[model samples]
Target: MIKKLLVGIVIITALALAGVYYAIEQAKSYLQTPLALNQAELVTITPGTSFNRAIGLLVAQGWLSETPYLRLLPKLYPELTNVKAGTYQLVAPLTAYDALAQFTQGKEHQFTITLVEGSRFSEWRQQLAQAPHLTHQLTELSEAEIAAKLGVDREKLEGLFLAETYHYTAGTTDVALLQRAQRNLERVLKKHWAQRDAALPLRSEYDALTLASIIEKETAIASERSRVASVFINRLNLGMRLQTDPTVIYGMGEAYDGNIRKKDLRTATPYNTYMINGLPPTPIAMVGEAAIAAALSPEQSDYLYFVASGRGDHVFSKTLAEHNRAVRAYLKVLRNQ
Candidate 1:
């Protein structure tokens, strides 16, 4: 009976020792294993996620063993909570510790967003609705709702967001990005606003932006910015109707699709320069710093009218007769088609 009892004790001790060894070995795997993970996949996390969500993401990414280790690891290393929310590349041989470290200290995955010049807020609404990384849903949102939520009034955000590619981490807020863009516009305007020709007839920075938006819409040609701006400036100086097409298009609002109609030209809105004697109620398109500067410091010229030649370029005319002739020629070409 004594021998049997002693044998039973020895077996229990051995099993306990084996279990301890196993636990320690698993714990040490983070140090020795090489990470084998893909860089292309993005792991997106939200701000203020619960601990359970964090653990679930780890397990889903194969970063954690999903056993009690998921709970144990965080308990053992409380610093795991410091990991920032972003897209991350999960590779292998990396234990939960290493994975957590990578998330906290390593480079985050960046997403790309391109805001084009002359793009409207309604268009941005669609783009933002489809974006994957931005943590907001704008599909069902209206123009007013988006402006209110993002704090970027549609009229103001127009021609205010610079046309460029912006890189941001996953889970970036649409509002934050719009604010960032607005801030950039403010900085650029401040610098160039002072250098503007004091004798120019622009009434305010708002008026300058309004003209800049026109310049942005009339031509994509960098060389043409100063000239286009000059025409508008001359019109303002001469107290002539700006008669820009963009404003009439802006007035079309929801009716505008890909095509601009002649009937739409006669329809009037506050933005219609053909109907309004002065600057539009707001900018018609998004403008960059360069366009804004060109509006402020327009090229000195006698040109007052321009007509597109069906090409990307336009022909500038100094007098009404010259403009009418060019218009007749372009219209003739259109008729020939």
Candidate 2:
């Protein structure tokens, strides 16, 4: 009787173990199975949002309303409690395990903003304000306040950021984006300044950046950047005024219309390079890497003047006489137009 009882007990234990194995397999299968949401939707997990809240949102969206995986998921993987806060693009047919993994890994949806070359700080702010998905924080702040907030120890706000496309996940603030662009400019400036050509007129990284901004505004042709840079450098070396119209326009602020008249050039302001002896007090506009490189390493040329050649390009001249003739040619082209 004892032997028969022992064998029955062993058989019961085996059955229980088999049942437990079957349950484990079923749970794994459930976690792997995809539940179609019938459509794609943007899911936002705000800062400090709990995983439970995210699951609740999923249910309220009618996607996982009847799904039991929300409860079972945490029980299986407790570490998934650390869901990141950002916007996420949730598509249908996502597996419970995969979806949970995305949250845990902070796989949020990415948004991008492009800062164009020659854009002013105000324009940068405007673009940031209009950028969708970014948390707007700089809309009401003044330039001084913005500079302080961005941790830049400068008085002026213009030309502090680099011109480039930056990508960020949603919930990123405008200040944060500006900070990133600032750091990028700093990095690029430092790197290029360190590798700069010997005996360049640039006194500091800021000076090089200022010169670069001028170069950026002077010509749109990529090949002419070095030549334009040379003109400014030569003028600086010869104690001649830069006489660039862009700087004068910048100093004019709100007063400047589309045209730069003779009076505008004659008027003296801090940023009026035509009046000022050297580089501007600050960069007039955002500068690109090419312009920065050109500023530091200008091509060897005797050319000191550049005017529009009537063909969307500039006529670079080495002498005043040549420049005057080129100006006359440009004037004739304008007259014909």
Candidate 3:
């Protein structure tokens, strides 16, 4: 009787082990082949969802080979408890076990959005609205609203962020992300500001940056930046009007006809450089680090006047006569007759 009982116990243990071996073997066979796979797709996991919902989503999306195996996944593999939430690239035609492992390990989706240098707040607003991954609309947000929402000061946001492509997931806060951009700019600017040449007459880093914004608006040429910086520094020393064309353009607001007529320069506004002296009350546009550095450590020169010589470059001059000559050359290019 004892022998018979032992044999029965042995049979039951062998049967359980056989079932375990069969399940594992079946799982492996299904996971290895690429059998009529569907195209990979983006899956968004919203906050406060469950593993059951994820399995349902996979099955509904035709990604999983077996739906019943979903509940059994955590039991078969203990790592499923560590799955994270966010956007993921779900690859189709995957075995249930393999899909579980993939999701359990957590793959986050990412995208890049650029905040170009010199973009106006309005332009940035539009860009934020259009971004696929970013979740905030900062362009239309009032300065006060942005400050309240992000817990930042409204008046101190000028030139806060770098103009470059930033990487992020979808649903990133526009205001918070922009704040990060602002922090990035501040960190970089401070680092560079410390290394600036000590001989400059600038009162502060912000003051140098203010002048740099003006110089940046003056031209587009990479080589012309320092020369523009030179002319502005000279003018600041002599206490002369900036007399910049871009400032006139900025003052026009929405009414600007894109043509800077002779009379437009005469229009009186706070942004009009022909009317105002020294730096404008605020930056005309978002300036880059190069412009800030150039402002702080300007090229040492006696040049007090500069005129665009056409071809997207400008000619520098220390005298009115030299400037007038450049003005004629640029006028000739514009006339082309």
Candidate 4:
């Protein structure tokens, strides 16, 4: 009777081991199974979310199936439970194991917002308002308030942020992104200012930025920037009015009807280069690094005037007579067109 009891105990132990092996095999299979995703989807994991809760959310969304084996995954691979909090992108044909790996490795989905050169600060704000997956903290704040949040001392926010593509995760704040851009602008401006030509007519780095914004608006051609800078620099040296039309348009603000009239040029405003003696009180637009560099170290030339060639380029001139001739040629081209 005692021998029979020992045999029964051995049999029970064997069955328990078999059950454990089967459970482990099922968990491994579940981990390797592909998710039920028809297309790419976004999954947001908020801060302090637990691993089990995240798995439950996936199962509820039908991306994953309800199974006891999913609970065994963390026990089998301890690292699978260390999921980071952020938005993740799950693509089809990806196995459940790989998706979990993405979470564990903190491989969050990235989004980009590009701040374009020659665009106004107001336009940038509009873009930020429309950006997806970004937290809008500055929607109700005025420009001055936003600047204060960014730790900027100036009241004017124009030309303070750099024009570049900024990358962010799902929960990134608009003010945070702007802060990065502002820091980048400060770093770049400081470096360039230290390297600028000593003989430049610019009184400070701010003056260079102001000039760069003008150059950014004047031309879109990459090769014409330095030459455009040269023309403006020459005008400044000769104490002549810049006579730039972009500044006039900026000064007109909402009153500008896509045309600059004789009276508009005669109107006195701080931004009107035709009426002002030097650079505008502030930058009129966001500027690129190339424009800034050109402003700090303009090309050495006798050019003082430029007009559109009607061929997506400019005709630069050293004398008023030559500039008038080029202007007539530009008008003729426009008339023919």
Candidate 5:
């Protein structure tokens, strides 16, 4: 009787071991088998999405098809509960196990948008509204409303965001991107403001930003920024009107018809530096770091005026006569064209 009992026990143990080995082999094969995908698909996982919901999403992508294997996936691997939320690109022929691993590892897709220097805040709004996959929260909000919502007490929005390429995941809110840009601008502005040249006629950091925006619009030439900034600084010191066409254009608002008539310059408006005594109420456009530096530490020169040389550059002048000559030369170039 003892011998028979021992044989029964040994047979039961061998059967259990064979079953374990078969289950492991089947699991390996199932994990290694690639899914039937023709091309890469983009997937968005929201925050706190359950494993069941994720599986459903995979099924929606035409993979697994509610197979028993998929049903058992969560029970088989309960430790994969902390899947991150992001946009992910799933490539074709990826195995089920590999897909799960990708989710678990949080390999999210990144998108980018560039805020160009010298762009007006209105242009920034249009670009943000058109950026793909970003949650548009600023569409209906006024610039002042946006500032209030973002904890900024300012009445305007120009020059608040730094001009640069910002990378983010799909589902990031426009407000969040704006916050990043504002913080970046604050940091840079603070640093440059602290290092500014002494006895500048500018009132504050905002003054520097305002001036920088003007400088940015004045010329795109890298070497011309300081000289242009110097011209403005010299004008301010001598109590002369800025007489900048860009400011006049800004003051004209939507009424500007791509042409700056003599009447437009003569018109009095808050933003028209020709009529106003100092910097405008706010910046006219987004400014870059180079323009900011130029505003803070302008090149010391007798230049009080600048006119476009028609070569995508500007010619600086010390006197009104020189500036008039440069203007005539530019007009001649335009007529010759």
Candidate 6:
């Protein structure tokens, strides 16, 4: 009878071992199983959200199935429980293991907003207001108030933010993003200003930025930037009015109807470079690094004038006669078109 009892105990131990192995296999399968999602979805986990609660929320949303094996996941791999809080993008054909891995690794969904070169600060504000999932803190604030918040002068805020694609997770404030851009601009501008040509005639970094903005508005052609800069620099040296039409359009504000009248050039405004003898009071628009670099280090040339060639580029000229001929040619092209 004692021998029989020993045999029964051995059998019971064997069955218990088998049950443990089966449970582990089931949990592993559950981890590898794809989530029940037909489309991509965003899941936001607020701060202090527990791993279990996150799983439960997914289950409730029908993206995940409730199973006993899910409880075993954390026990089998302890690191799976260390989920970070942020918005995550879950796509189809992804397994439960993959989703959990993303959460634990803090792979939050990233959104991007591009601030274009030569665009106005007011236009940038409109873009930020329309960006999805971004926290809108500057919606009601005036431009002056926003500048004050950023510790910048209200009048000098137009061209301060760098033009670049900024990426951030959800809940990022517009002001926070602007601050990052502004900081990047400051660092870049400082570095470029220090390396600038001494004969540039720029009084300060702000002067370079103002000049850069004009260059930015003048041309979108990559090769034309430094040449355009040279024209402006030559004109500045000769004490010639910039006479740039973009400044006139900027001065016209809402009254500009896709055309600049001769009278507009004569009308005096702070931004009217035609009437203003020097650089405008502030930059008319945002400028990229390329424009800024050109402003600080212009191509050496005697060019004093430029006009659209009607071929998506400018015909640069060193004399008024050449410039007038080019302008007449441009008008002929316009008339023919």
RMSD of each: 5.7, 3.8, 3.6, 1.9, 3.2, 1.4
Q: How many residue pairs clash in all the candidates, one count each?
A: 9, 0, 2, 0, 0, 0
Tens digit of per-residue lDDT, candidate 2, span 139-189: 998888888888879988777788999999887899888888888888998
Return the candidate ranking by lDDT, descending.
6, 4, 5, 2, 1, 3
**Candidate 6 lDDT tens digits, 51-121:** 78878878888887878866677889788888899999999998888888888899999998999999999
Q: Write the per-residue lDDT of candidate 5 for residues 70-160, one digit (tens) a residue.
A: 4555656766656778888778778867776777789887789999999998999999999999999999999889999999989889899
Candidate 1 ranges beyond 4 A from true positions:
1-39, 44-85, 90-101, 137-157, 257-263, 332-337
- Residues 1-337 of candidate 3: C-alpha lDDT, one tens digit per residue: 9999999999999999998787776645554534234677677766755667766676576655453444444466576556567887656565554555666666676778888777666677678788886776676667667767767655645454566778887778887678778787787678767987776656676667667677767776667777788888778778888888877887898979879988888888888888888777766776777777777667788998888777767788889998898899899999994
Candidate 1 backbone collisions, by pair: 33-93, 34-92, 34-93, 35-92, 35-93, 36-92, 37-91, 37-92, 159-286
Cα lDDT tens digits for candidate 4, 247-291: 999989999998889999999999989888999999999988888
Q: Report every candidate's CA lDDT.
A: 0.76, 0.85, 0.72, 0.90, 0.86, 0.90
**Superposition-based RMSD of candidate 3 using all C-alpha atoms, in angstroms:** 3.6
Rank order (by TM-score, best first): 6, 4, 5, 3, 2, 1
User: What's the lDDT for residue 146 in model 2?
Assistant: 84
Question: Model 3: which residue pairs collide?
Answer: 125-139, 160-182
lDDT of 6: 0.90
Clashes of 6: 0
What's the true lDDT of residue 27 in model 3? 49
RMSD of 1: 5.7
TM-score of each: 0.73, 0.82, 0.83, 0.94, 0.85, 0.96
